[model samples]
Target chain A: MNEVIELLQSHRSIRKFTDQKIPRDLFLELIRAGQSAATSNHVQAYSIIHVRNQANREKIAELAGGQKYIADCSDFLVFCGDMKRPTDSAERAGADVIRGMTEQFLVASVDTALMAQNVVIAAESAGLGICYIGGIRNNPAEISELLKLPEHVFPVFGLCLGYPDQDPNVKPRLPVESILKEDYYREDEAMVDGFDETMRDYYGQRTGGTKDTNWSKQLSPLFNAKLRPHMREFLVKRGFELK
Target chain B: MNEVIELLQSHRSIRKFTDQKIPRDLFLELIRAGQSAATSNHVQAYSIIHVRNQANREKIAELAGGQKYIADCSDFLVFCGDMKRPTDSAERAGADVIRGMTEQFLVASVDTALMAQNVVIAAESAGLGICYIGGIRNNPAEISELLKLPEHVFPVFGLCLGYPDQDPNVKPRLPVESILKEDYYREDEAMVDGFDETMRDYYGQRTGGTKDTNWSKQLSPLFNAKLRPHMREFLVKRGFELK
Candidate 1:
């Protein structure tokens, strides 16, 4: 396998970081790499807010379910799904633009994600470590206000970037058969069962046999209760009416 | 810059492809690389349907706004945001799982995009070309039935992968100052105006001086009217109620 593929395959989310900070030039280069990602219709409906203030970073960390890494990381970034800039530009070009639609939300969110993935890949390639902080959604409104995000824009997720101080194992994924269908969707109970066992072993080994749960059991918290119930209202208030 | 950064910076959507077919092993490797992408909570809530049947490919091509590249590419994949498997597995593992919520929808969609971007990077590194088809939303209900997608699972986007027969110029993006904000969000009207001029020149040059419209003008169609109005209902029917 080539270096790029190898780098991709060896991916892991890094939480603990050293004191080293990324150079300004290199950080800008990483954002440039992110911009090179494929955007739907070239709309580029996304933005990244670098949380440079220590007080703001700490506040954000608290808001994001106490993910202290947000405060500790060398750099913290909040990636926002932005539709305002494009729509406003279109309006200036003489189009009576509709403000919010379901597709707009999907496009902006997907656009943000695609670009962020490119940033992650670029960071990893430069021997940096990274972790995705989806906990930002736990308190989206506060995060948005703190970031000064305007209407028609919402914070999708946060990312922590720094040099690694701890190395975590690459997490296991569901088997190929379970995810890759031939032409249509097909249920694979057997493969799911097999993967559960694989994950059971992985968690046991990774956690020194203390945490004994499979992938399925582990997902209970995410689904047993309504997750981030405020997201719909938050998104709508942010101008993603989903109409 | 490193090879990975260079590969990322040089990305261009290739709509024309050679007759060369990707080997099965290499394609599987690409999917494996996709699996390595970071998923929200390790939910891995995504699936990929490889549409190899010519008739199905052609139908999907028509469904996706007559993008002939869907039919012409050596391999076409429909990336799905699947919440069914994980929910089912979690239920089977003794959790009373909720069916649909806005967060679930966001997670599934973002998960699919993250995985797909990795596949794109891996494919490009191997000298392959890819185009993401968001037009699938135009007829999502029909496409879902055609692919036999179950409830709690929906097609996010389609990807056309193949060896390139045409070399398109890399599309330009908005200036970094506009997209990357420091500490808080800041508007960059000047940057946007400058980018419009850049896009005007790009469109003219790429189309041999026939296309004179800038980025803002090109976005008129997307915002001037209700876009894919059926998507909200279609997603609701597919069990992503966005509640």
Candidate 2:
């Protein structure tokens, strides 16, 4: 693999960070790199809220199930799936704008994800560490309210960026054959079993035998519970309609 | 900017592709790079369908609204947002698996986008070109059926990959101030207005002065109509209930 492919492969989410602040210029460059991602139909349906307010960060930390990094990181950003700008631009051009279509919701989320990943890769390449906080989905309505998100805008996730205080090994992934199929969708149960063993060994060694579970075993809690059941109504209220 | 950031920003959707195929080893490396992307709770909820069959590729080309690149590209991949493997593994492990939460839908879509973007970057870095065909959402059901995609899996988008047959200019983006906000969500109408002029020149020059469109005007058709209104029901049929 080339340097770019190697960089892409060597990604690990950073949780602990040093007190070093990212310079304003480099931060802006990361955002520009994000904006360069391929967007759907060139409709850049995403926004990032740079949460610099300490009080707001603490509240968001509690709202996201006590994720203290949201408050402690050098900079925290709320990545939002936003259709308002594009739709509003269309309306201003005198087109009869139809909002809240399901595809709009899907496209906005995908666009945000693509742009955010570019930001992540760029951040990693710049010797800064970053972690994506999916915990924001834990309280989307409150997070959106805190961010003052308007119609056709929803908080998709948050990110904590800073210089690393701790380093973690890159977690292994499913074998390529498991996810990449030729011509049709298929299952790879054997691959999962093998990956579970790999994860078990990694977790045990990483935590010095404290974290005992494998990947398959760990997923039980996630699927056994109806995670984020409130998100549907919350998104609809935020004008995603999703219908 | 460093080499990685430069590569990230240099991205352009390459529609025309040369006949040279990507070597199998490099192709697998691309998939491996995709696997390195972050997944929610380690639930890698996505799959890539390598469309090797010419007939299926042609049908997908038509199903994706006459996107001939699906057939002409050396490799065309259907990136699907798949929740089956994770949830099914959970169920097999004897969890009373709850399925079809809206958050699951959001996570799967985001996960797929992140992984696919990594693949895009890796491909580009390897001197291959790529295009994301969002038009696949137009007839997702037909395309899904053709690909034999099972329950809890949905085609999010398609990718066309090959050596470049055309060299297109890197598209300019909305100014950083427009999307990168401070503490709260805000509209950047003024910045967007400035970007429109930039795009006007890009589109005209890229098409030899034949094309006439700016960023805002280009978004009119996408928002003026309820794009892909059938997606909700189709997703429901595919077992994404999104509830």
Candidate 3:
């Protein structure tokens, strides 16, 4: 396999990072790579903040569900979905601007996400490790306040980057057949059942002993748990009409 | 700059692609990269289908608003938010499988998108160019029927990838300040004004001495006219209870 393929196939989330500061130029290059991603209709409705200050990183780590790895990483970036940029531009251009509910918000979130993922790959290719911190949304208001985000902008996620200090095991995924459908999307019962062994092996690989639980066993509670309740109201409060 | 940074910083959507086939090993690498992306709590709620059959690609292209590039590309991939896999697993485990209209759906969508971006980066790193086809959602019913997508899965987008047959200018993006916030999300009007020259330069460069318009002018109608109407209902029908 080609070098790029090898890199992609071997990618694992690096949680522990060495205290090496990513060079300023490489940091800029990471953002540049992110900016090069495709935006909806080329509107580019996203922005990223490279949080390098130790104090700020510490605060962010606390904000992102007290994850120390966030603060410990050399580079911490917050990706935001922004609508105000274009609206402001339209206002400045003396043109009528009408954006609400659907594409405006969706485009920004998706665009930001795409750009962030590009940063992840680029960082990885640069021999850096990255872990995305979606837990930032757990306290969106605080994140916005900390980042000074405007009403039309909200944090989609945070990314921590640095050289890997520890090598995490490759997390298992559901079978491609379970996820990939051909000419139409259909559920495969057998594929889902087979995913149990993979999940069990993944858990066993993570720890010496198996958890003895399948994917559904681990995830079923999450549906009725704390993660779902606040997300909708949080999005609404962040000014995404979500209509 | 390192090679990876250059690859990312110079990224552009290639709408025109050669008809050569992507190597199977490279395809496997791209899919693995897609699988490597972080999922919401590792639920990994996404899947993709590689459409190599030319006739099927043509039909998808026709269904997706006559974007000939979809059919002409070496490979066309459809990314989907898959809840069925987990739901079916839950059913097998004798747990009540509820597809709530909440964060689960959003997580699935975001997860699918995150994986798609990884695939895009992997493809690009392998010297392939890609164009994301958001037009797939233009007629979701036909795409669903053609792809045999089940109820709990929604087609987020499609991607056309191959060697580039054309070299498009690097699309310009808003300045960092326009989107990035400092402490809290706040809109700095001056920063946006500073970007007008940048936008104008991008427009001029893109048009090659022909007529050109600023970003806002070009994108407003696309949001208001073409995509706004059908997306909400389409999403709802796809088992997203947008309560």
Candidate 4:
């Protein structure tokens, strides 16, 4: 395998970080790399908010379910799905643009994720550790207000970037057979069963045999309750009406 | 800049491809690299359907706004955002799993995009070309039936991967200052105006001076009318109620 593929395959989310801060130039380069990601119709409907203020970062950390890494990381960034720019630009170009549509939300969200993945890859290549903070969505409204995000824009997720201070084992994934199908959507109970065992072993080993749960069991909280149920209204209030 | 950054910055969507089929092993490796992408809460809620049947691919091409590249590429894949498997597994593992929620939809969508971006990077590193086909959403219900997608599982986008037979110029993006903000969101009308000119030049040069429109003008159709207005109802019908 080549270095790029190897780098991708050896991926792991880093939580703990050292005291080293990224050089300003390198950080800018990482954002440049992010901007290079494939955008649908070249709309580029995304923005990154660098959270530099200590007070704001701490507030964000609390909002994101107490993910202290947001405060501790050398740099924390909130990636937002933006639709205002394109719509406003189109209106300026003489088009009576519609404000909210389902496709617009999908485009902006997917575009943001694609760009952030490129940033993650670039940071890891430079021997930096990074973690995606989806917890930011737990309180999107507060985070948006804290970052002064305008209407037609919403914070999709946060990312923590810094030098590594702790080494975590690469997390296991579902088996290849479970995820890849030939020509149709096929269900393989055997593959799922096999993967559950693998995850069971992984969780046990990772937590020193103290955690006795498989992937499915771990996903209970996410599925058992209404997960961030306010997101629909929040997104609509942020101007992604999903119309 | 390193090879990864270079590879990312040099990305262009390739629609024309050679007839050489990707070896099965290499194809599997690409998917493996995709799985290495960071997923939300280890949900890994995505599936890739490899459409090898010529008839199905042609039909998909028809469904996707006659993008012939769908049928022409060496391999065509439909990337799906799947909440079914996780919810089912979790329910079976003794959780009273809820069916559809907005957060679930967002997580699955973001997870699928992150994984697909990794596949794109891995493919490009191996000298392969890829084009993301969002047009599949034009007939998502038909496409879902064609692929036999279950409830809580929907195709986000299609990908055409193969050896390139055409070299397209890398598309330009908006200026860094416009997309990156320190501490809070900011707007720069001048940056957008400047980028419109850059895009106008790019389109003119790439199309041999036939295309006269700039980026803002090009986005007119997307916003002037209700583009893909059926997507919201479609997602609801597909069990992503966005509730």
Candidate 5:
């Protein structure tokens, strides 16, 4: 396989890692990759905080739903969808920066997320492992305060990066046709068929037999979960008026 | 700089292009990079529709807010947030999949965006040019029907890709400190100095000393424009009940 193909096919989330520090150059390269990502209107509404202090990492791990991997990883980064940059810029220019809506908030989140994925790819190419910690969003205000975020900025997620101690199996994806469409958006029945086979095979390998769990079984309940119920209201409370 | 680093540092959204088709292998590699991106719970709730037909590209270009470059590009891909894959799996297992709510929808949208950015990176590394078209969301329902999307799958954005015929200047980014936080989020005067200098120099080079815009001047009007004002209701209407 070519380097990109190998990178794609062999990729897996690494929650466990060996105790080794990431080289500074590789870290810089990863951030450079992230910064290079395309931003909405080229505004680049995002920021990253790298935490190397053990005490800080431990606190972040506890804050991130008690995920131990956060502290265990060699490097931890918190990605924030930031509006403060522009807000600050407005002050410098003597202009008003008005933002109290979902579109702007989502733009920042989307921008940060887009950049984070680039960081993930760059880190992987450098032989590093990464696990995204969405748990960081569970307590956005606390995480923001803990990270000392200014107003108009919110933390979207955190990433734990390090050298892998174990090689996890590559996660199976829905078939190419399921995701790749033609000229128009055609909802082909073949998509379900092909993806069902992939999921079945993936589950079979994971359980050494056909498991009752499938993609839907795992996904449906996640939406019904209590913690995620008031996310819209939470966004509103966090200054994103979903108009 | 390494090839990847150069790609990262020199990224520009090419809104103009010459008539040249991207090679199939290079196209596939870009898709592979899209697949390698992290997904929430590995659900991979996204789809890419590659449009090669000139007539179709022309129509899509028209629908994408009158962007002529889209019609001129050799290939166009519409990245979509798809919830049907898991919903179908749930139905096959006789489970309720309607739990696909707003948060889930956002997850899919974020997931697709992350993947799309990688596609852009890979394309750029191979000497291809790309520009994201968010105007697709301006009329989601019409675009959805045109793309033959089933329920619960919404059009997120469009990407125009082809070989580059122009070398756009590197866009300036806010200084590292502006977004980079220490232990916690600290918003003070310190984040502004270096960035202002960096961006002023950048703008001076790009646009003569006469008409230079800083980050704030570029972004504040977007909020005032009330773009995608009804995106929330539109999303709900499109099958994502933000429960």
Candidate 6:
């Protein structure tokens, strides 16, 4: 109904970016808006690392499954879920802090995601385009070593931000009825089956008839291959325990 | 900065709300905005439960650590991280889906948070206020059973939305420097100390000098007390396994 809602609805990830870099002031302002997102119990458990070195950016781009936009974008930031800052600070202040609880992991990850989403909205609204690099988790151990992340902090994702050089259609989503339920969780099998048809049409049209996959079939590569099977060991080694 | 940026920076949690209910269409529109957020691999691993029953809301309010606002708000939405639908769909399509990789848990949780944050922005933009209810995790078992949530679906957080009856001052956040680093993970104890001072002043003013606490001291109850220690078992029981 408003410009803000319109902005939210029109969000589409941009991979190709123009050469113009975001001004330092504007970049910092985006972080400010991100910090304004609500944090659980005011823990604010997150850290954003701005990768400025060209070599590091290139390395990360490859580490994140060859996503070249990470190196090409004006700025690439690694958003990390950090329990270290809060728990360490609390301990130093004389509280016998607990560490490595699963709840802590959940809260920190959720806090980081919430903060980053605000950054995305703020960036998109300011005529900047952004892409979330979930592929970074594919090589979390090496990426963390490269960035010198400490114990109790794991990189959740990377974000690439810049002025868009290309325009793409907004990807269609599952209908609202399929995900939103009243009072209790209900089955939405028929709705999902209908969505498969919708996606088939979307992919066909978007790819000029080259791609012939529906949403369900498209998930085969990710689900059947045991995606990111090493993530548990990595997180535990990074002090999450996830217990 | 534009109005969208201003709105993002001006966010504050509203615990007290007016009795006026949001129109049905507007609420659904907010969900639509939420679905527009980026999902990892287009998994769209989330579900929003609209708890419209009066008694259920009251029970949920108590379950979420006695937050009466859950019962009083125009709507209380439990944002659930759902892997069941996606994995099941993939299996039905003939893929041998791996059930509970830790990365699956991370992606689903992140997707849920990103989606809910979008809904929050849309609600705030529409002149409705929201309070995130992180306390629901305190007793997730009872709450999940109450909502009849199936396996592989876990409640991540709740959102209380309505027209504000009280306009609280925007809560101060840690300076961007504290959370935003350059190239590496850096120590920010000094910045955190400075923010403690800022929060001290904010709380003093907000509570008319009745509460005397800094951010560090305020974290004692949560960290020192081993907040939500049962979450690991609860999540495992709910099929997250987090393995």
lDDT of 5: 0.74
lDDT of each: 0.93, 0.92, 0.76, 0.93, 0.74, 0.94
Q: Place model 5 in a CAPRI quality band.
A: medium
Query: What TM-score would each prediction reach against the true structure?
Result: 0.99, 0.98, 0.92, 0.99, 0.91, 0.99
lDDT of 1 by residue, A1-243 (tens): 778999999999999999999999989989999999999888999999999999999999999999999999999999999999999989999999997798899999999999999999999999999999999999999999999999999999999999999988898888887899999999977898999899999989988999989988999888999999999999999989999
Candidate 2 per-residue C-alpha lDDT over A1-243 given as tens digits, one digit per residue, 9 for 90 to 100? 799899999999888889999999889889999999999998999999999999999999999899898888899999999899999888887789998888999999999999999999999999999889999988898888888899889999999999999878899999899999999987889999998899999999989999988888889999999988999999989988887
Give the per-residue lDDT digits (tens) of candidate 1, residues B43-62: 99999999988999999999
Query: Candidates 3 and 6: which is better by lDDT?
Result: 6
Off by over 4 Å in 4: none
User: How would you encode candidate 5's per-residue C-alpha lDDT over B35-132 as one tens digit per residue?
Assistant: 87788877787888787677767777787778988788878888888877766666665654455454676677788888898788778767789998
Model 2: CA > 4 A from native: B207-212
DockQ of each: 0.88, 0.88, 0.53, 0.86, 0.53, 0.86
What is the DockQ of the complex in model 6?
Answer: 0.86
Worst 10 residues of 5 chain A by lDDT: A221-230
Interface RMSD, Å, model 3: 2.5
Better structure of 1 and 2 per TM-score: 1
- Scored against the true structure, residue B32 in model 3 reaches a CA lDDT of 78
Q: RMSD, each candidate, Å?
A: 0.8, 1.3, 2.4, 0.9, 2.6, 0.9
What residue pairs are clashing in model 5? A147-B184, A147-B185, A148-B184, A148-B185, A149-B185, A185-B147, A185-B148
Ranking 1 against 5 by lDDT, winner: 1
lDDT of 1: 0.93
Q: Tell me the tens digit of each residue's lDDT in model 5 across A18-124.
A: 98898877777788878877887876788888876788788888877899999999889998877767656665666555665556766787788888887887788
